[model samples]
Target chain A: MTVTDNPRSYHYSDNFLDFTDEPARSRITKFEPGNAAREQTILRKLGINGWGRWQYFRTCFSDQWGESKQRPLSPRSQDRFFEALEKLRIPKDSKASVFLTDEGNLELVWLDDADEQVQIEFGPKDFEVYIEGSGIDDQYSYDRLDEIIDRFFAG
Target chain B: MSVSGTEDIARAICSDKWDAETGILSASLFKGAETSVSRLSITPLEDTWTVFRKNVEKPPERLLDRIGIINVQSLMDIGSNFEANPTRLSVEPDPLDGYPSHAIIPQKISRGLANKILKSLDIREEVK
Candidate 1:
C-alpha cells in the first residue's frame, strides 16, 4: 500500500507481473531511475498529455492476487499512446505494432531485425510477457478478456 | 459520430506545442466536447483550479464509474491495513482515493534499442 511518486515505480509493477508465475531472476535487469526519466521525457517528447491519452490509472488487486498495481491505459489510451509511440524511435529495422485483443488487453509486438517476435500484454492493472519465440498462451491470454471493456471505459 | 472527431481532437491536443494559448484552445475544445478541459489548459493556476473543479464534477460518468470501483478497492485495502497496524500508517486518508496503492518502478528501454528507435523516429537530435 505504499504510493510511489516516480513513474519508474510502475516498472516494478511490471516486474511483479513478469515474475508472477516464475520468480524473476535477480539478474533480470531492473530499470534505473534515469531510464524512467527517459521514459517520461519520451512521453513528453511524443507529446502525450492529459487524461485518457497515455494516462495511467489505479488498479486494485485482491490480497489473493499478491501485490496490487496500477494498470496502463485503456484501449483508447492504448491507441493514442501507441500512435504517439509510433512517433518514437525504436530499434533499427524493428517493427512495433499494438493490438487490442478481443478481450480488451493490449498486445504489443516488437519484431526484431531478424523478424523474431516478442509479445507482451498490457491489461487494466498489469503488463505480462505473453509469448516469446512465436508461441501463444491462450489460457492466460483470454482469462481476463471480460475486463478489457471495463478497463477501456475506466481509462 | 463525434467519437472520431473527439479522437482527432485528442491527437491534435497531444501533438500540439504546449503553450499558454494552445492550452487555452485545448481547454475550450475539450470542454465543448463534454470532456474535462481544465487540465488541457495552461491558464493561471487559480483559474485552472476553478475549471478543474467544475469540469471534473460530472466527468465522463461512464469513465468515472469504472475508475470508482478500483478506487473503492484501494481505499478498503488501505483501511484494512490501518486497522491491522495503525502505528505503522503515516499518511492521512487519501483525498484522491483513486490514487494507485503500490509504488511504480521505472523500466528503461534497452540503450541499444533506444538508440535504434531514436534513429528510426528521425528525432535523434531531440534525444541528447
Candidate 2:
C-alpha cells in the first residue's frame, strides 16, 4: 500500500461516538478549529474515559491554542498521550488539569490527598513524574507507566 | 515601572491553558522552555498587557484572551523553593515592544514549582 494509504497513518476511527446527543456547546468559543462534527470526532479520538477533560485537551491540537504560536501537538506526542491514558487509573472523582508543553508533549496534573500537585509529563518516548512539595521526581519509560500508576493510586 | 512583591500580576492565558473541568490554570502556562530569555512574561494589573496595544475597536477580543492573576508575593514564595545558584527569585520589569507593563519572573522554574505557582493563582477570570 502507498505510504499515505497506510491505515496506521490515520489518527482516529471515523465512527466512535454521537456527540450530537450531548448538551449544546459551552461558553468557550475562541478555540474552535472546525465544525461540530469535527470537534466531536476530536473528542472521540481522545477516548471517552476522561470525557470531562477531553474538550480542553482537544483544543491543544489547534494552532491558536497558545498566544505566541506554540507548536501544534505533534503526532508522536499524541500517540504517546493516548496510549498512556489507557493505562492510567485516574481517580473517578478527582479532577486533573491537562496541558501541552512547549515541546508539544502532554502533561497531566492532579492534586494529591495532601493538596499538593502531582504532575505526569509525557514525552514521545518517556514520561516524567513530579510530586509538588515532595522529593518524588523521576522519569520512566512507557513500559513502566502501569507500574507507576498502580503505585501512586495504591490504597 | 518597578515590580513589587506586594502587587498582583496578570498573565494572559490562551483558552487552552485554562481548564474548564478544574476551573484553574495549567502549570504548562508558566514554562520557560520556549522563552530564550529564561523568563516567563507577566504584567502588573495596574497597567495590564493591553496597555501595549494601540487603537482597536475591540481591544481585548482581538487578543488570545484570559487573564490569570497571581500575587507577586505568592510567586516569590514559590520561587524561593526553586532558588538557582543561591540567587533568590524575584519579578523584574522587562518592557518590550512598548509594553512597559511587561515584567518577568527571572528564573528557570521547574514543573513542580510551576504547579505550585499555578495553585497560588488568586484569580482566573475572562478579560472584558
Candidate 3:
C-alpha cells in the first residue's frame, strides 16, 4: 500500500510507529542533551524512514570536527532541522541526506523519483530552502515550521 | 603541465561529503564563508589520475576514499539564478610539497553554485 493509503500499516511493517500528537514546533525550542523526553519526542516522530539521517545529525553534533576548523554542528540549527524532519517525513522510496556545513549549520536534502529536490539549510533563527523540479528552480527563506510544511510539504 | 580551464580537477571527498546509497554528492563539499573569498583546495588532474589520487591524503578518521572530478570550465561556467550570469569565481595553482597538481578556488561559494558544480561531477570511490 502507498504511504498515504495506509501510513500506520506501512509504518508498522517497518516496526516504527510515531506516537505523538504534540506539535513539532513546541519540542524544538531548545535541545538538551540528556533530556530523554525531548529526544524521544523528536525521535519517535522520525519513525524508521528518518532514523538513519537523525543518527547522522547526532554523529556530526558530537564529532565537533572539520578539516579547516573546529566547526561543530550548531545545536539550534540541529533543533530546527529536527523540527523540519518531524513535519516532513522522507518517503520510503525517496532519499534524504544530511550534511554539516562550514558555518556550523545543518543542511537536509530531499530527492524523489520525479526529479523533485528540496534542500534546506537550518539556521538558528531561520532556514533557507531550494526547490527544483518541473521547471521550478527557486529559493526561499522561512522561519515557521508549519508554513514550511504547508508551502512545500503539502500536496 | 599547467592547469587550464579545459582540464578536469579532482578533489578528495570524505565520507560525509557524499552518499553511497544515492550516489549523490553533497553541495557542502563546496561551502565557504559568506563574506570574503575562501580557499577550496583541489588537484588538477594533469593527465595523472593515479599520482594525484595517491598524493592527496586525509586522516584515517576522514578517509580520502572518494574523488570528485569536475572540469575547471564547469566552475568557470557556473550558472546563476537559473540563468547564465557572470561569476567572479576563479581557480589557480597553489601547489604544496608532494602535491604539484594542487589548485585552489579562491572565492565565496554559494550553495546554489556548489549544487550546480557537484551535479556536474563524476565521483569515483575507493581512490586510495
Candidate 4:
C-alpha cells in the first residue's frame, strides 16, 4: 500500500447502496482551486451563519420527542466545528447551512446552483464528507478534520 | 439500548432492523444518492429519549425501546459502510445541539414540504 498526502493517491469510495437496485454514476468535479474569499462573499449574500439560534434547535427537535435528549452542544466540539469550517476552505461557492447532530457534532451542507449537495458531519475523532450529484453518491473520511476539508477544496 | 444501544441504531440505519442489545429506534432517512441521505436515530436515556439526525429529510420513525445503552468505547467497532461526514449530525450525549441540530440539514425539501412534515410529526400539536 502507498502512503501519501496527495488526493490522487486516495481511492474513490466503493461502498454505495443503490436501494434503486441499479447502477449510478457519481457527480463530482475536481478543478483548479477557487478563491475562498469569493465563496465567503457569496455565503454572506446567501445569509447563512451556521444557525446560532437556540430557537432553531427548539424548532427542529420540536417538543415532540420531549426528553432531556436535547442538550446544548459542548464548547469543545462546537468550537472544533467552527474551526473545521475555516479549514474546509472550499473554493467552490454554493449555498450552505450548518446543523448539529444529536451527539452535538456539527454538520454543514452546501448546494451549488446546479442543485448538487455536499454534506459534512464533524465527528469527535474524525470527519466525513459526502457529495451528492446526478446519478451517484460518494463518501470520504479523514483521520484529521482538515484532511476532509482539503478534499472538499481540491475535489 | 437496553444493554447496548450502539449496535441497535447502527443496524437500524443500515438494515432497518431492531437489535435487542442496543437501545435505539429505527430512524434512518435516505434521500437522493447515499451521500445525500439523512439519518434519524433514537435511544432511551435514563430519563428521556435521545434522537439523532444526520440530515433532516422526512418524518420520524416509529419509536421503540432497545436493550440498553451500548458502551461508547466500543462504538468505533460497530462499523458502518458509509463515511461519517462532519457536515451532518452524529448522535451523542450533550446539552447543546450540533451545528443546526435536529430537523435541519440535508435540506432539499421545500419550506412548504418541511412545514408540512413538521406539522405532521409535531406531537405537541395534534394533527387534524
RMSD of each: 20.5, 9.8, 13.6, 18.7
The estimated TM-scores of all candidates read: 0.21, 0.62, 0.68, 0.35
Docking class of 4: incorrect
Q: What is the lDDT of residue B118 in candidate 2?
A: 69
Tell me the tens digit of each residue's lDDT in model 1 across A29-142: 234344355356434443333222222221211011101222222433343333333343445445444332322344444554555544444544444442234343222233
In candidate 4, which residue ranges exceed 4 Å CA deviation? A1-71, A90-93, A134-143, B1-128
| CAPRI-style docking class of model 1 based on DockQ | incorrect
Considering summed lDDT, which 10 consecutive residues are worst modelled in model 2 chain A?
A: A20-29
| Chain B superposition TM-score per model | 0.17, 0.64, 0.69, 0.23
Which candidate tops lDDT? 3
Give lDDT: candidate 4, residue B44: 29
Reference-based lDDT, each prediction: 0.28, 0.56, 0.58, 0.34
In CAPRI terms, model 2 is classed as: acceptable
Give candidate 1's error at residue A144 in angstroms.
Answer: 19
Q: What's each prediction's clash count?
A: 11, 0, 0, 45
Candidate 4 accuracy as TM-score: 0.35
What order do candidates take by DockQ, descending? 2, 3, 4, 1
Q: How far is candidate 4 from the true structure (C-alpha RMSD, Å)?
A: 18.7
Which ranges of candidate 2 are over 4 A from the true structure?
A1-65, A110-117, A131-135, A153-155, B1-7, B33-66, B71-74, B82-87, B124-128
| TM-score of structure candidate 1 | 0.21
Candidate with the greatest DockQ versus the true structure: 2
Look at candidate 2 and tell me the lDDT of residue B82: 55
